[model samples]
Target: MTTIGDFMLGGHAACDDLFAQAENAAGDWPRAEGALGVFRDTLLEHIAMEEEVLFPAFEDESGAAQGGPSETMRAEHQQMRALLEQMADAARAHDERRYLGAADTLLMLMQQHNMKEESMMYPMIEAAAGTRADELIAQCRAIELRSAGTCTCSRHGAATA
Candidate 1:
């Protein structure tokens, strides 16, 4: 029964953990590779969920803000994506400095991004989302679960399944 914010926030934290582990490995390519894989997928799915579901819901809920939080989050997503791509390239090339550099950027980005969402964005959603909150959140969770090859809600027009 997790909300979209809850689920995606968990994903962001998972990505952070992977980044931390990679940085802690101190140039161990194999260890970094394993952590980097988790970092990659978690970030990808987290962004996909926001863009495809949660952001749109927030936009609908608070046009007064004119998609304010969602817009900022999207920009941050781009920054995170860039760092992730760099990390991937470095990991593939087995370059410790490059990998750690990208990991450092990711850590900063994630820490700030999480703060905005947990403080400003989520409270705004709770205040303004009205009755649609429950339904929209349900749809988002269904999308996540289906994306992970689990439950199939099949309610989101095209496919939440």
Candidate 2:
């Protein structure tokens, strides 16, 4: 069903979608500012998901060296936050060069981050979460949607998409 891995995967895809939209707009998007806001909100929410829940779960489960994946992911998230701040500033200034460069950097970082979670961390979380895995995943899914304003993030009633 909805494991943290799956939830995070969807979020990564959403980030990619926002990135793609921004790239298509390039130096001419009248709404580039709003678009960047959406991207920032979505990215921040995704990072928060990992920082608040998934990373801890994985840390407790796998126990990789030096806290392992969770540790690395945290550092990456911090790096990403910095990049996002820079990108946001560039967008606000309408600096095409800076925005595009930051976009390229973010795209590479995001793809790599997605790969790490999908390939390494997710499986561990799945096994570790066990019977509660479904419940936790459900919570994550709700958060994703709520962050999107599509619905509430509570484990009440059936989820749509």
Candidate 3:
């Protein structure tokens, strides 16, 4: 059984790896540009899966529709997006110092945000949603970001890279 926490924790690790790759390439504008773009897109896609699929389902199941952890998470997501934009701008200007500063801030924020989600939000979602948790997670996994060229899941008869 693929628990919600398991899936989301894996996603957090994947995003972290991508972020590190971008950070490592910060001194090289050519490499940093491409690496950062991938990180940004992948992180955005992760946020979309939570906001569009998991969070909504958890909200409905838990009946905290107006305000709750989901709202808090969404706000943090916005903050992360803003930081990503800053990083992009700094990269475009070829300012490694400014880029690293934003990356540092973003890395700290992401660590905290992911901790809250993994330790509290995801577990709460699993407990509240029960059997439906599986469905919600499946929906999240099924989401293909706009930047993702082709479907890689076996259900679509596409080869996974």
Candidate 4:
């Protein structure tokens, strides 16, 4: 069975790969910007899946709507969104230095955020949501497919490219 953890981990890896591609493009402004665009889109899709589908399911199942880890994660998502905008602007201007700096900060934030979700939040969700977990993951996969315009969840029964 494909778990939420597995699904999210795959997204994390894919996002990292995209970022690495951007970083490797380095002096090539067009290539770097293109890769960053893909990275931003993919990351946003992952965030949306969690914020729109998983988090709500988790909050309902765990009864932490008022305040909890999900709230903290949501806040982090906002911070990341701001950083993504900054990075996008930097890329648009072809400011590699600025882009790298923002990318570094964003990477650190994402690593910490991902760890919390994978280690703490996902287990709580799995235990609380039980059989419904699969359904929620499927929903998340659908969101990814729609946002990415490509499949990113082969394990969840979606085509992978």
Ranked by lDDT, top first: 3, 4, 2, 1
- Winning candidate number (lDDT): 3
lDDT on C-alpha atoms for all candidate structures: 0.71, 0.73, 0.85, 0.83
Q: Please, what are the lDDT tens digits per residue for candidate 1 over residues 122-152? A: 6666667666667767666666566566323
TM-score, each model? 0.78, 0.82, 0.90, 0.89
In the range 1-161, model 4's lDDT, one tens digit per residue, is 88888888999998888878877775688988777777878888889988899888888888898779889999999999999898888888888898888888889999999898889988888887888988898898788667645534333234445
After superposing candidate 1 on the true structure, give the runs of residues whose Cα lies further than 4 Å from its correct spot: 1-8, 64-67, 150-161
lDDT, candidate 2, 18-134, per-residue tens: 878766566764677666766777788778777777667666766753857678888888888888887778877878899889888988897898898899878877777777776
Could you tell me the lDDT of residue 70 within candidate 3?
94
Poorest 10 consecutive residues by lDDT, candidate 2: 151-160
Clashing pairs in 3: none
RMSD of each: 5.8, 4.2, 3.3, 3.2
Q: Show where candidate 3 strays beyond 4 Å.
A: 145-147, 150-161
Better of 2 and 4 by lDDT: 4
Candidate closest to the true structure, highest TM-score? 3
Model 3 poorest ten-residue lDDT run: 151-160
User: Measured by TM-score, how close is model 3 to the native structure?
Assistant: 0.90
Candidate 4, 3: how far from true, in Å? Answer: 1.1
